[model samples]
Target: MLLNMNFIVKALLGLCLVNSAFSARILFVMIAPSLSHHIFFRHLIKELSFRGHDVVSISPDPMNDPKLTNITEIDIHTETYDAFDARKWLETVQYNKPSSEISLMRSFLPLFYTQADNVLSAPKVQELIQNKNEHFDLVIVEMLMFNAHLFALRERFNCPAIGLASLDTSLNAMDAIGNPTDPNYYGSFFTEFSGGNLSFWERLQLLWHHIDFRLYYYLEYLPISDAMIAKHFNITDKTAWDLEKSVDLILTNTNPIFHIPRPKVPNYIDIGGMHMRERKPLPKDLKQFLDDSKQGVIYFSLGSNVKSTNLPAEKRAAILNVFRQLPYNILWKWENDTLPDKPANVLIKSWLPQQDVLDHPNLKAFITQGGIQSMEEAIRSNVPLICMPFGGDQKFNARRIADLGIGRRLPFDDITADTFLDAITDVASNPKYKKSITKLASVLWDQPTKPLDRAVWWVEYVIRHGGAKHLRSPAADFPWYKYLMLDIIGFILAVVIIALIVIIKVIKLLFRIIPLKKIKLKEQ
Candidate 1:
């Protein structure tokens, strides 16, 4: 018996050692100022730390949870918020403005550049970067806006890096991972055009935008970012492009149910809705309000970044006018102490537990700005949407909701009491929108692996393999001409031109000989 016990103890000790070896030390950087964006990264960060990884997180929003002992949070919220006032930017957005992706990016680049500089200069970030004694097995970075932090992949820590995006893959992210930017079918977040059935003008506009955006990015944005990287980190050996291509994998927040299906490389993984968790109980007042609403409730919120309080007085009145006439109760996320001229049936709250509220059975329709995360929550709860997008990807997501037959999209600038009432009534009274979204939600939940688990698995896979270099697409190495097969097309055109010339010359010579022979015969 003693001999058997000794053998079992040794085996158990070996397993513990193996488990310890697998736990990685990760440097997770999520410095974006938006809270909605951070929520997604926060879930992943907590999951990794809970799974025994020593996660060092650098973010503008820190969870500061004392129970999460495995994570070391480096806060840069103050500096980042100061650099870019999200609220001011949101307030200034023209809801009626058309999409001009290149122009929009051009205006935002300087702001992002300044924000990146501030993030790097923050005391905690500086200390973390300069600490040569600290090492990590992996580094994860949010690949939106500014990617100056990518310099850490090589210059600061010689380890593999994983790029994370809070929204569907962007043109720059696709370019970095060597994935095809199928602009014809997959119009970017800023553009309303998506899918293959495009008009002649739409096709023309898309192609022009693709070329124009690429020129601006490569010529202007890239050089500025490269200079910033060099100045901040003393990284003279690699440009921003070089660092972008060094990414081992890209995890995008996209799903086939929500985003158009497109070709993607192996390393470009979709872990959309990874932040989704089981619905919790709602607060008593909200719960009672929903329970008492016999006609059902319509939920309204513009999401975290865009505040409803900032809506123009006319627009706010229009929304309120519609709410007053509706038999159904309204729950609005107002983001203010009180709403002026509020309806008796409508309840306004400064903040809401959005997911829990959506999960309530009495909730019928969602009036939203069509943010991706909000759409995911609504889809899961089988709530149809009435999207009035303001800016950014919201336009694309709103258009998609209409295209998918999951709901309706209203133009914010075009909205009035009648239009608002029509949209809400159509979406809430009609059964088709709810049914379509329900079917989509089923598809979303039918995946073999849960999104969070899949994300965690990929993170660990990178650690286990030391890098996902083998999975990197070969197209990443191809230049523009080669990738487009322009060389082959040029060669084929040359051969055809030469053959055509030879045939014409031979025909001319034959005609001349025949005319001379006829003249000679006549003279004889």
Candidate 2:
């Protein structure tokens, strides 16, 4: 019996060792200033910490989670630059140019660089780099902006680097991983084209944007970001352009089931709904609102970035005016307490438990900005949406919503009381909208593993394997002309031309010989 007990103890110890093997020291750099954008990384951090891994996160808004003992938080303040300023983009939208989004990105890159540079230059980051004792198994970076700067962290820790895209339809991340971005298959996040099989004209437009985007990065974004990396990291051996190509994996925030279907490299893992969770109890007030609504509730939110309160007086009135006409009880996520004429049916909250409220059985419709989070929540809950996009991929997501028959997108400039009223009525009254989203939710939930589990597993897989270098596509090494097959096309064209010239010369020589032979025969 004593011998048996000894064996059992040894087995138990082995089990403990096996369990402990999964734990990793991970470095996460999330410099995205936007609150909603930060949530994606926050969920990833939380998941890693729960799995008994040690996570050191550098973020603008750090989650001071006392529960996760292994997680370390380093704060970077970028509220001034990162905070959702609707006014800036709203003015750009007024221009009605397709390139307007590109212009906004150009304006925002300076501020994005400022925050990235500040985080790298922070004393804590510097100390971490200088400390020889500090080591990490992996480094994860949000690839929204400042990919180059975060790569510096990967080198500092001497570990594998993984990029997590903050938004869905990240053409930049797709391009960086050497994933094909053919206009025939993929739509620009700026456009509302559901680009599965695009028309000739549609493909041309997408191609133009594709070419312009490569030019923009090569000419503008990369050079400036390289300067920031050069200054802060003090490394002469590599430029930012070089570091950007070295990422081991890209954790994309996209679900092909919900997104425009396109080819992705094996390294680009889709963990789009990674943040989705089992429903928790709603806040007391929110619960009461849903409980009290006999006719069901309409939840309206522009996500965290675009403040509904930032809407101009006329726009605000237009939205409020629609809510007044709706029969169902309205729950609008207004940033401010007071609005001009909030009807009796409408209830305004500074912040609402968005996921919890979406989970409510009493939810008839969601009036949302086409933020992927909001759309995912609405889809997960199997509720229909009325998408009035503010900026960024909201428009793209909105278009997908409409294309999928899950929602309708009406532009803000054209969003009158009648259009808003009609959209709410159409989505709410139609059972097909709810049905379509429910079908999509099934495919989203029907993954081999839960998104969070897949995400954690991939993260640990990178750790266990030391790095994901094998998954790296050879395409990243190719220049534009080579990757696009332009060189091969040029070579093929030259060969064909030379062959035709040889054939023509042979025909001419044959004719000359035949005529001379005929003359000789006639003389004979």
Best by lDDT: 1
Please, what are the lDDT tens digits per residue for candidate 2 over residues 211-238?
7666676677877767766786676688
What TM-score against the true fold does each predicted structure earn?
0.94, 0.93
Error of 1 at 68 (Å): 1.1
lDDT of 2 at 144: 56
Instruction: In angstroms, give how far residue 17 of model 1 lies from its true place.
Output: 2.3
lDDT of 1: 0.85
Off by over 4 Å in 1: 1-15, 86-92, 95-99, 148-152, 512-524
Q: lDDT of model 2 at residue 237?
A: 84
For model 2, the stretches where C-alpha displacement exceeds 4 angstroms are 1-12, 79-98, 517-524
Worst 10 residues of 2 by lDDT: 78-87
User: Against the true structure, whose TM-score is highest?
Assistant: 1
